[model samples]
Every structure is written in C-alpha cells, then in structure tokens.
Target: MPGSLSAYLSQVEEDGADYVVIDTPPHAGGTIDAAIRAADLVVIPIRPGPFDINAAAGTVGIMKQTGRPGIFVLSQVAAVGPEGDDTAAVLQELYPDVPVAKARLGQRKAFMQALISGQAITEFDRPSSKAVGEIKALFREVRSRL
Candidate 1:
C-alpha cells in the first residue's frame, strides 16, 4: 500500500486507462510528494481563503521542482461574491504561469448529499442540475488539457 504510487501509475498506463485521478492530502507527505512527482499534470484544489492558498503554494513549488505542470481548481467557492475572484487574483499574482481554472465548484448541498448517498454527483438525483453541469465542465476542461 505504501510506496506503490509508481507501480499503480504503471499499472494504469499498462492497462490503457483514459485518465488517472489521484487525490492527495492538503499537507505534504510521502504519498502526496510521490504522486506530484509522478503526475503528468497536477490539479491542486484550493478553497477560497488565504490559508489554503498559502498551503497550495508549497505544493506548487514541489510540482515546479518536479518539472510538472499544475493548475488550480477553486473548490467549494461561494457563488454570489467577489471572494472567489479575489482569491483567483491572489493565485494568479502568485503563480502567473499556472492556469487558474475558470470553472469554480460552488458550495452546494448537492455535493454533500451525494457523498451521504455513497454516489457521485452525476449518479445522484437530477443529474442535469447545475451542480452536475459544473462538475462535467470541470472534468471536460481537465480532460482536454491532459
């Protein structure tokens, strides 16, 4: 289980998987480090706040050191406010080269409800809802870039 990230990635490649999404913890750890180093492109999901932004800076540094491209995805952002824009501005100023995702996943009850139901947002009721649309758009962006 430990130290098998590379092996798992190899297996995915060998199996011809279309996409490999590895979710890493916010803090730096061995597994996250290994995943960032091995990732073709790293997606760092950050909340709209100073602390989260700062934390992501450290991770971005590691991605840069590994010579891997990394993008920022603003998660659980409030829809009706300038806070998300401000946060995106801060990230853009900090990492001018890194692309800040245009698609922001707004904080909604649907996501939590889906989690409680042990299903993905798409699998939840009202698959054509706005919540599902945002996720689908985000996925398409990530997929196209990859």
Candidate 2:
C-alpha cells in the first residue's frame, strides 16, 4: 500500500493527465505521505478557526519533510468577518515560508448546491456569482504557483 498511490499517479501521468488532485484526510498516514511525495504543489485548505489552524501544522510539517512547496487556501470562510484576515495573519506568522492564498472560498449555499449536483461552483452557480469568482481566482493562483 505504501507505493500503490505512487504507482497510480505514475500511471495517470503516463496517460497524459495534466494534473492529479488528491484529497487526503486530515490525518497522518502512509496514504498522505505517498500523496505528498507525488505532489508537485500541495494545496492545504485551512478553515478560519483555532482547531483547523492548529491541525494544519502537521501537514505543513509533512510538506517540509518532503521538501514540497505548498500554499494555504482559506476554505469556508465567512463572507463578512475579521476571522479570515486574522487566520491568514496567523498562518503567515506561524509559517513564514509558506504563502497564504488571497483567494478564499466563502461559506455560501452555492458550494453545497454544487456538491449536491455533482458539479463545480463555476458550473452550478451563475458566472457572475461570488462563489464562481472565488473558485476562479483560487484556480488562477494555484495555476500560477504550479
């Protein structure tokens, strides 16, 4: 099982896949290790809360150990509040080497609706919707980093 993920990723690459996004659970394990090893850029999603911020340290540690660059994207952030900014500041202060993304996914119904419909927010929501904008901006930032 240790090398299974790597082998699968290798096959995906062989099949001309442009990118492979592996969403691992918020815990330490062989699967997470393998995913980190195979990643070109690890995108860590952190919610604006004390527990989420603290939990992210483990993933950050893994990234450092693997020497893989990563960015922290704020997820499910409130539309109007200081929590998002405060969290970003804390993340930057705690991990000066890693960058916190400017684009944040806000807490909106569109995201849940998209999930229920098995579609992305860009596809499920109106083009001019804020949720769509947030996703697009995040994609652009992630693309630039890659």
Which of the numbered candidates is closest to the native, going by highest lDDT? 2
Go through the candidates in order and give each one's C-alpha lDDT.
Answer: 0.86, 0.91
Residue 106, candidate 2: how far off, in angstroms?
A: 0.7
Tens-place lDDT per residue, model 2, 12-54, is 9899998789999879588788788788899999999999999
Rate residue 13 of model 2 by lDDT.
85
Q: List the residue pairs that clash in candidate 2.
A: none
RMSD (Å) of each candidate, 1 decimal: 1.4, 1.1
**Clashes per candidate, residues 3 or more apart or on different chains:** 0, 0
Poorest 10 consecutive residues by lDDT, candidate 2: 1-10
Instruction: Report how far off residue 120 is in candidate 1 (Å).
Output: 1.2
lDDT score, residue 44, model 1?
Answer: 85
Model 2 RMSD in Å is: 1.1
> Which candidate leads the pack in TM-score?
2
